[model samples]
Target: MSNYSIKAISNASNDAIIQLKELNISFGITEKTSETLPNPAELFLGSFAACILKNVERFSGLMQFGYKKAELLVNAVRLENPPRMDELTYELTIYTQDEKLNSTLLKKNIEKFGTIYNTVKQTCKISGNIIVHKNV
Candidate 1:
């Protein structure tokens, strides 16, 4: 993974391309990206969740913490009049007993450092909490 910090997660959104070095992922995105892909809202929700998960790996290294795994469940509310995602909530579970793991700091970093999270929060109401499981 790339080195990332609360201040170092400095990339702005709206680019057509994304690359994940560790995962060997490099793809260019476009409007109506792929017919095989899920609908826009579903894709957005996946992106939202992905951002959080990515940040967990990110902050874990930057913050010097360890975790076995992390899981996230994201739920959204749809508005039909204009067709939009109005609200988003997430349940994030991090399985770790690292003494250095700080939930409060982690949550704040994830929220502030996330690309999709920041973009979505600009227009939608977002609320979520991080659950740290010490013995898993």
Candidate 2:
């Protein structure tokens, strides 16, 4: 197993930022009273969305799929008692000129082989729907 570590620091006004080393990315977090940025929980949801989006694009290329445009939307509901994400839903729309593309196959490739999807699906209720938009 590969192990990783990162660091986060809080600024003077209670604004905090965490840097992800593997990806060389950083995100800011803060509270309404402390700062204007979103909290950590919201960042988690955004991270999940970003991870899936990146994976889907890579998978689409590997599967030799024709696409004109693509978009993804992610929503997550957090539980109040235990402070955990309870339900997560995703909607992915793919636009392409080819009508013979098997959406089911694309979805299977994503759900079955996507490293991030598989990892997150194990702990949370992860569900996604795929839609194909035919080009005119």
Candidate 3:
């Protein structure tokens, strides 16, 4: 098994920074909120979306498919009583000439192979649909 780790440091305020290699991401700690930085919940949802997109690119190469571009939108529903994500929904749009032929297969591979996707699906209700737009 391979082990991965990230480093995070926080000051006295409600702000923290996470480091992964050369990347640095700032997040808010307290409920006070900040327009510049994401909160913990937002970061969680964003990580899910990022994982799906990364897999989309990986599967495209492995399956020998081509696409002009891809876009993803994600939303999460939080339960008030428990204060946790109850459900998550995502919409992925892929711009490619071969629309109907490969969309389903690509979507299947992403759900099957994505690490974060599978992990999140275990605890929260995850659902999404893919839209293939044939590039002109």
Candidate 4:
């Protein structure tokens, strides 16, 4: 089993910071949350986004495909009563001229193999589509 650990510290009046690896991320906490720093919910969604992107890079070599770049847009809705995210949608745009890239297969691989995507989709509704733009 893989293991991971991080540390976070904050005062009641100041923003919290999480020491992850060699990087320090300062984020909002309680009333300290603002537009400047990402809140917990946004961070959660960011993790999901990162997982998807990471898998894309991993699958590129496995599937024998090359791409110029990939862009993803994620949208989420939070339910106030239970105070949780209820829905998430994503649009992935891949810029590539590779004929080996299969959109359907790639989507299935992401949904099945992604760690964070599976975790969030267990309780939250997730719907998305992949669009491929060919280069001329």
TM agreement with the true structure for every prediction: 0.72, 0.78, 0.91, 0.94
Q: Please tell me which model should have the higher lDDT, number 1 or number 3.
A: 3
- Ranking according to lDDT, highest score first: 4, 3, 1, 2
lDDT per residue (tens digit) for residues 4-106 in model 3? 9999999886689999999999898866666767988899998998999999889888888888888999999999987899999999998888543488888
Which of the numbered candidates is closest to the native, going by highest lDDT? 4
Sort by TM-score, top down from the best: 4, 3, 2, 1
Query: Where in model 2 is the C-alpha error above 4 Å?
Result: 1-3, 21-29, 33-36
Candidate 4 residue lDDT tens string, 29-49: 867368789988888988999
lDDT of 2 at 136: 39
C-alpha RMSD values across all candidates? 8.1, 2.9, 1.7, 1.4
Total backbone collisions, model 1 = 0
Q: Candidate 2, residue 30: CA error in Å?
A: 3.9
Judged by lDDT against the true structure, how good is candidate 3? 0.88
Per-residue lDDT of model 1, residues 4-123, tens digit only: 422112124322323344432222243444544344467578889989999999999999999999999999999999988899999999998888999999999998989889989999
> Considering TM-score, which of the candidate structures 3 and 4 is the better prediction for this target?
4
In model 4, the runs with Cα more than 4 Å from the true position are: 30-33
- Predicted model with the maximum TM-score: 4
Q: Locate the minimum summed-lDDT window of 10 residues in model 3.
A: 97-106
